[model samples]
Target: MNAAVHIPEYFEDCDLVEGEDLVREPAFWLAHVLLTMGDPGEVERYGVDASAYEAMVDRLADPGQPWPVLRVCFTGGHTAYVVYANFEDENNVDFFVRHPAWGRLGHLGQCGADEAGPGLSWAELISLAASAQDGEEGLSDPSQRLLLLLPMLGDADMPGGARDTVARALAGCGIRPDAAGELAASLLGEQDSTGGPRWTVTGDSPIAVCSSPYSPRRVPLGLGISPEQAQALANALHGSVPPTASGGFTG
Candidate 1:
């Protein structure tokens, strides 16, 4: 179940960015895809060889390419896969999620347009994946679910205005507003070992948000969740407010 084996050879040398927090901004996901599409300034900043980078982009953009252009690996051999053959020519992309234990592949959703019209953007698809995986174990604790949802705030003022937002959201789940506010502030302000906001839910082998090896972006990864729960949570969080467009990617 070594998920790394699933990574295509073309991306072998490319850096893998991981994290636990759900990144909710379309711009954040779009920026990464756009970077791979060719950002001369970003290439120069990263000191990547111009010609070599262009060659990788060419291979990724090949119309006949069959593998995913990007793979977001989660804990326990779960992965969220993305395919976009030519970002320059089309804004569309397809998304899939795989669970090794279940031996099942789930079509989460798609980004961009088709005969069915516009689809979810990359940000939306990622958010859906995160939410689905976060609730996979079926942790019913209001506080735990709050932790799972907090990262979706994405750089918002936590324990300040955002505390009220979390409290309000939790109130609907039966938590008192005042206690919910306190819990939200406590969790949002705490940092993980990497100095990023914490996202560890409480339970045996509890799910924790972890930082990416090569980038600042964080995503939640864990085990024991059913695909049905993943889909249900994804559908619920899909309507939540989108993240504000302020963060920037460094890798």
Candidate 2:
């Protein structure tokens, strides 16, 4: 953690505490595992475009006022397991509300104490969230706090398929496949990689898969996604939309 990042007066007022010890927290650990294998550049590599990626992150940060609990999440690593805030407060919420595609879904909008609303409508909320900024203080790294909130994707605490898929996706972004595999295991709390957990990605059209030398299971390629990519998919799965899309998600 950078000392410069810790000097924000708002955090102090919010009773926020910052430290590396956050890695020990369950939330941070899980998030770290996922991010360890995540590649922040997936959108660019996959041809999703930089602006689209940024817009996706913005949407995740603040879903809207009615459904303020959700937040955006993405991989962050200078090295070691790292996470990024995606969304930490009201400004993000307000921006998402006013954005065209995302604003219509009232209950799913991202919300926090920082927003002002006549109870902002869907359109208003998307617009606000899209326009919100970090101000001169710069952005806050609330990765530690956001991880605790990542919803369990399956019946188990961590979804083995989701973790592996995310790692594979990161690998496609140029990370080493072995490292991505290890990261997947770490994020799912599956410390040992020996057990062959079967998984597959069904592409829009069928695609060939290669079996891992280490495991009998075949790995999916086109299905690969980074932490941010995973988060974007998750938001879509949860029924939210990006502001630019008339329907929220791109078909």
Per-residue lDDT over 9-120 for candidate 1, one digit per residue giving the tens place of the 0 to 100 score: 2234432222122122222222333332223343333333456556655544454544333444433445555555344356444444555554444443343443111122
Which stretches of model 2 miss by more than 4 angstroms? Answer: 1-9, 12-160, 191-237, 240-251
Report the Cα RMSD per candidate.
Answer: 16.4, 18.4
Residue pairs of candidate 1 with colliding backbone atoms:
18-212, 19-218, 19-219, 20-218, 20-219, 20-220, 136-225
Among all windows of 10 consecutive residues in model 2, the one with the lowest summed lDDT is 74-83
Candidate 2 is scored at a TM of 0.23
Local accuracy by lDDT, each model: 0.37, 0.30
lDDT for model 1, on a 0 to 1 scale? Answer: 0.37
Error of 1 at 162 (Å): 16
